[model samples]
Target chain A: EAGVVQSPRYKIIEKKQPVAFWCNPISGHNTLYWYLQNLGQGPELLIRYENEEAVDDSQLPKDRFSAERLKGVDSTLKIQPAELGDSAVYLCASSFSGGDGYTFGSGTRLTVV
Target chain B: GESVGLHLPTLSVQEGDNSIINCAYSNSASDYFIWYKQESGKGPQFIIDIRSNMDKRQGQRVTVLLNKTVKHLSLQIAATQPGDSAVYFCAERKGGSYIPTFGRGTSLIVHP
Candidate 1:
């Protein structure tokens, strides 16, 4: 079975520029999540989708960040007018349902200059 | 709000020895706990999980112990190997919550 997939394994953007990351979840998985991991820290949930509907997104920065799972099979995370502190590894994960073990993508390492 | 935190930032152990990683959580409502192992350049992979109702759960070579009274969690790896070197994180999910809160993480270094 294929694991969760993410594009642009690495991204570098200047401060104030815009950047986007994509994620493709595993087939038949009903839950998808976006997380941010800074250096020497564990992954923190940015948003969660339950079959195309965002169930939780309190941690996302509303001013410059947004995410969508239009079809529920894939999702996108965007950060506009990025800041240096936004540099981190963005991880995408999928699970069968709530509270299930997650299968994570390799992640996109974002570096804001 | 639930908060998961690791007791140590780093641990060094000799190969073939056992290693123990510890975590502390703040929410008494949290019922589900999980351990994840993340290698360099990769995301976290599930290692083992234990529910609040259960004190211990064992996987292939790993064991997770949870103490709800003190909100302490631990992962024990038997006969640790070089391949076991990685960052380990403990996460918790409350009874009615779907999103899990993660700890800061502990880096395990196994030296041969």
Candidate 2:
């Protein structure tokens, strides 16, 4: 089976500009997650979705970051007026359910200057 | 706040030798733990997992040991090869939650 897919393997944007990353989770997977990873650091959960509903987003910076999972299949994470600190890899992962291990995508490398 | 951390930032081993990576987690309530290998420019790939009830779980070439009493976790690789070189991360999931908390990874370098 094909693994989780993410678009635009790399992206460079100016600070204060808007940026978006897309993700397509595995087929039949019901849980999707967006994580931010800095150099030499572990991935930090930004948002988690169970189908179309986002169940966990407490860590997301609501003022600048927003995410959506439409139709419970694909997801997009948007950062408006991106900051220089936003430069990091945006990873997407999916699991069959809350009990299964996650399958991660290659991730989108975002660089904000 | 709950957190997971590794004892070493990097580990170096000669080929054909055994490699061990250690992690310490603060959450005693965590019931599930996973080990992941991440090569440069790639996302993390699952290596193995062990439940809180189990003291050890073995995979093809990897072994995951869980010490619930000390809140410790370790991953051991037998006959390590250069292909095994990568950053390894340990993640813990709370007993009732699906969300996992990840620790800073340990970079493993296998010398051939």
Candidate 3:
């Protein structure tokens, strides 16, 4: 079975530029999540999606960060006018409903200069 | 504002020895716990998991012990190898919730 897939494994952009990351979860998984990880720290939840509906997104920055899960299979996380602090690894994970563990992607490492 | 935290930021062990990593969680309502191993430039990979109802769960050479009395969780890696060198994180999830909160990771360095 294939693991979670993410594109543009490394991204470098200037501050104030827009950047987007994409994720394709494992087949048949019903739950998807987006997380941000800073250097030397664990991942922090940004948003979670149960199918097409976002059940929890309180941690997402509404001013510039936005996410969408279309058809509940693929997801996209965007940060508009990115800041230097936004430089971190963006990780995506998916799991089966009521499953024991989650499958994670390799993640996109974003570098904002 | 419950949180999960690790006791050690880094641990160095000789290869073939056993290693223990510890975590403490503030949320008593969290019923599900997971241990994830993350390598450089990669996302966290699930190593083992234990529920509140379980005190211990074992998989491969990894074991997870949950002590609800003190809200402590631990991961034990036996016969550690160089491949086991990575950052280990403990995550907790409340009952009836799928979202998990991750703690700062413990970096394990297995010296050969």
Candidate 4:
């Protein structure tokens, strides 16, 4: 079985441009998460979806960041007017349930100049 | 007010030796904890997890320990190898939340 899959392994954009990332979670997984990881820092939860419903998004920057999981199997994270500090790896993970360990994708490295 | 942080920013250990990574959490309501290993240019992979009900949980060459009293978590790797070099993060999940909040991470460098 394949693990979680993410698109555009890398992306580079100038500041103030828009950027988006796609993620496909593991089969049969009911929970999906989007995280942002900066250099020398750990991955931080941006949002979490449980079968199409975003259960947690408190950490997400609502002003510039938005995410959606329409079908519950795939998710997209978008950043409008991206800033230099937005340069980081966007990781997507999925798990069987809320408490289980997650299976992560390779992640999309975003470089904003 | 809830946060998880590592005791060290990096750990350097010789091959064949054991490595212990420590974390301190501030949330007592966190009922679940997990350890994730992230290689360069990749996302984090779960190594092991321990619930508040349990003190320790073991996996292949890895172990996770939780101390609710002190709100601490630790990951121990036996016979560490160069392949074990990576950033390790500890995550804590509250009872009602679906996602776990991650720590700052600790870089583990295994020497040959």
lDDT of each: 0.92, 0.94, 0.93, 0.90
The TM-score each candidate achieves on chain A is: 0.96, 0.97, 0.96, 0.96
TM accuracy, model 2: 0.97
Give me the candidate number with maximum DockQ: 2
Candidate 2 local distance difference test against the native: 0.94
What DockQ does each candidate score versus the true complex, computed on alpha carbons?
0.83, 0.83, 0.78, 0.71
Top candidate (TM-score): 2
Docking class of 3: medium
Supply the DockQ value of model 2.
Answer: 0.83
Q: What is the interface RMSD of each candidate, in Å?
A: 1.2, 1.0, 1.3, 1.5
Ranking by TM-score: 2, 1, 3, 4
What is the DockQ (computed on Cα atoms) for candidate 3?
A: 0.78
Determine which window of 10 residues in candidate 4 chain B has minimal summed lDDT: B92-101
Clashing pairs in 2: none
Query: Which is the winner by DockQ between candidate 3 and candidate 4?
Result: 3
Candidate 1 pairs with clashing backbones: none
**Per-candidate TM-score against the hidden true structure:** 0.96, 0.97, 0.96, 0.92
Candidate 1 accuracy as TM-score: 0.96
- Where does model 1 sit among the CAPRI classes? high
Report the lDDT tens digits of candidate 2 across residue range A23-52. Answer: 999999999999999988899999999999
Residue pairs with backbone overlap in model 3: none
Ranking by lDDT: 2, 3, 1, 4
Question: What docking grade does candidate 4 earn?
Answer: medium
